[model samples]
Target: MQKLDRAWLDRHPLPSPAIGGDKNARGRVLVVGGAEFVPGALRLTGEAVLRAGAGKLQMATVRAAAMSLAVLMPEAAMIALPADDDGEIASGAIELLGERLANCDTLVLGPGMSASERTEQLVAALLRGASAGQTIVLDAAALTCAGNLGTLVAAHEGRVIMTPHYGEMAYLTGIDAETIANDPVAAAERVAEKFNAIVVLKGARTVLAGAGEEAALFEGGSAGLATSGSGDVLAGVIGGIAARGAVPFTAAGWGVFIHGAAGEHAAKEIAEIGFLARDLLPAIPKLIANFGAG
Candidate 1:
């Protein structure tokens, strides 16, 4: 492998100049996840997309959660769906979700989703419908929900970007946590090829791979980001980038950089052990400023 240089990174910049365009033209990103038990996903994800520069972000979640998220995140559009007793989505919701999904340019799945049969069915349908023009990013619970991702990969015409922590990586890739922890780049690249999906293996140093390229490792962020809602925020960032017309690999690169930058800021005020996902909010603006987006 050749040594990575500064010029290599200078190549991957942010979105092209924003010409006169409609909000939908900027990008409409749909995030599919959240449950009765998990309201954090909806709020964090929606906010992250906005912070990452997406023009529109729509979150499809259980009705109750959607209501809560709407109140918490006024900027994010919420689509409510009926759910089971445990707040898990039911099959009936799929049809309603499908209608709205047709308008979305990108998808961000499994932030705070609960594993219900209905949720699984919804994911499968999205994968089937995902075409070359549309971009998709998978994270958190969605990684394990399918267990076998072959169908999703085979179904999607465009590329799929899957982000997994070490444990989730092991579960999805059938590798052990210890091995993934040691050689995350190699592990991410290997499994990405097997599934034929772009992989963003998350950790202290995030690794991205796709389009015949082997790997791009980004070391950014602080341990303070080890909070619950942080991953959801990261997913939103990538989804937002996708909505902005950036491809999967470029979005992942920016997402990884910004996610860590937010965490880095959050760590200054709070200890790494106790920092929460919300802590990264203020940091997000500062981070984006670094990108000259603000």
Candidate 2:
């Protein structure tokens, strides 16, 4: 395993924007997340995308919460997806996302979404609809569909990345969380190879494994990152980096390092264990600049 710290990252820098680049020149990211109860998730994610240096942002969420979330996050162009009875994005909403999905450089899915067969169907449909060149960043409930995706993710080559904490990792591999915690690298590798997607196993020592690639481990994020919606921020960070033209593996590595570093920054400014997920956002752009990256 390789350590995914500053030294390793310095040698593999992310692509920088041109001096006179426009918003579209940076990259476009489409974030499909949030339900009626968790509309703030899209705002957190969309903002993180911009902070990570992605150019344009589009937030797609349940229709019921779209108007309010749009007001909360005026930077992103909002798309209201049809909702099911439970306020989850309906599977049929893919019809509405077709053009956006095709235009986006990266698609960040599954944040704040409920885990259910319906979500799985939605995941599968979106995966199928995504263009060959689009990067897919799957988090939260979207990771649950891995076991059944088979060729769906593999078809993306190295473009699909999944971020899963211990419980979500266990669910993806059918291994108990305890067993996965014992050897997170191996757990991450198993899923990475099985799906042919980059696997980011998030924990105290996050393990990033890609199919046929060396595992990269990071162990520097603050405990405060354990708060609610933290993973959503991490997912958005990765998506934004990917949208900016970083390869999937490079994007995942940078995202992990930046997120952990951001948590440390937040811990110093706020309480080490009491900082909310939103507190980490302000530190992201500064962190990337400090690294001489985008």
Candidate 3:
């Protein structure tokens, strides 16, 4: 296992900006998530994507909430997907998202989504339809279907990344949460190999693993990061980084490190356990810029 730290980041710099490039040059990110009851979750993810340096953003969510979400997030171009009775994006969204999925440099899935058969179908279809080089970041309910669709995930080669907490990891791997928590690194590696994707096993001490023995560890975050929507921010950060040209493992390692560091920074300003998830957003660009400077 390797420690992911500032020194480690220095050795592996982010992609440098072009001398004269437009927003398109920075890359585009498409974030597909949110339900009527949890539209804010998708907004958080979309904002974090831009905060992490992706230039253009597209947010696809339940059609009912699209207009409101667009007003809340003016930076993102909104794509309203058909919604099921439960307000979840419907399986039919795959057709609406095909061109967007193909066009985006990175696709971030599952923030504020619920688990259901409809969700499973939507997730599977999206996973199967992602373009060859597009980076895919899966989190929350999107992960519930991943374990059953190994071939679809593996089709992307190493271009996919999954962020799952202990419970979510268990859901993806069919292992009990206790066993996974006992040795997360091993469990993360196992999942990564099984799906042929990079796995960010999030917890107090997050473990990022890719196919084979590759693994990186981050333990810098504080308890403040345990709040709701924090994982959404982390997913967006990773997706944005990937959109900007970092490989899956590189983006995961950096995203985990920055996220934890933001937690530590927030803890210093606010109480360790009281800071909101959105509090971590402002620190993101500052952290990235600091690394870019040195």
Candidate 4:
């Protein structure tokens, strides 16, 4: 892992006018996640993506959850997935996702998903179908499911962003959190190089890694972001920025800052524990503007 310090982030803020005067100019994000019991992941992701500046946000989820989410999250244009007997997405969901990905600039996968057979099928197909320049932010389960990290990178280089906390990172790399905690950059770079995608090793200081560039650590935010669905929100934020056509490392950096700053602001009124993951929504605009990242 490459050594990185805070100075690098102070130099590279996210670009402004995220999009031009047209709809296509602003990026579209397709978020694929949600199951019978965890449909909220899709809703949280869709909301977070839009809050972070994705012009158009689509939610692809099992048909069982579509109606509830459509009503709860009106902002998200929902794509109803074909489900199997267990109410989980079936292989047929891949076709629906493929159709959506054809029009989207990015994919945020595995937010509230279970390790169902069909879910695995759809995720595998996505890893196979994803191409260069199209960003894929794999969080939670999807990150772990792609067991053979090298093949994932070979499938699409510089297109994957794996957001893993200590446990997931330990599980994926066979390194304990203590070892990784002492040297997160090294762990981040090892996995990033293994998969050929930038890795956002989420923690006290988020580290970003990609091709050729030495890693950069973004230090900010608070424990308020350490909630249940916060990781899902982070994935959506990264996907939203990716929709803007920013490079993987830059996008991850911006996302880390945006989310952390949002958490910090949201905590002021909502109390660190009082505020939920979704509460970070209202803080996004000001956080973006205040950071001079615009």
TM-score of 2: 0.98
Instruction: Give the alpha carbon lDDT tens digit for every residue of 1-294 in model 1.
Output: 221223333566666737887777779988888888886677888888877778888888888777777888887788888888888776687778776778889888888886656666777877776666788888876766656657667455336888888888898778899988888878887877777778888877778876477578776678777778988888888888778877777777777777887777777777766788877766665565567433
The TM-scores, one per candidate, come to: 0.91, 0.98, 0.97, 0.91
Candidate 3 lDDT over 22-87, as tens digits, reads: 988888999999999898999889999999999899999999999999999999999999998888
The positional error of residue 38 in candidate 4, measured at the CA in angstroms, is: 1.0
Q: Give the Cα error of residue 25 in candidate 1, in Å.
A: 2.5
C-alpha RMSD values across all candidates: 2.4, 1.2, 1.1, 2.4
Off by more than 4 A, model 3: none
Clashing pairs in 4: none
Over all chains combined, what TM-score does candidate 1 have?
A: 0.91
- Count of residue pairs whose backbone atoms collide, per candidate: 1, 0, 0, 0
What is candidate 2's lDDT per residue for 105-185, written digit by digit as tens? 999999989887888888888899998888999988887865578688889997899998999888888899999999999
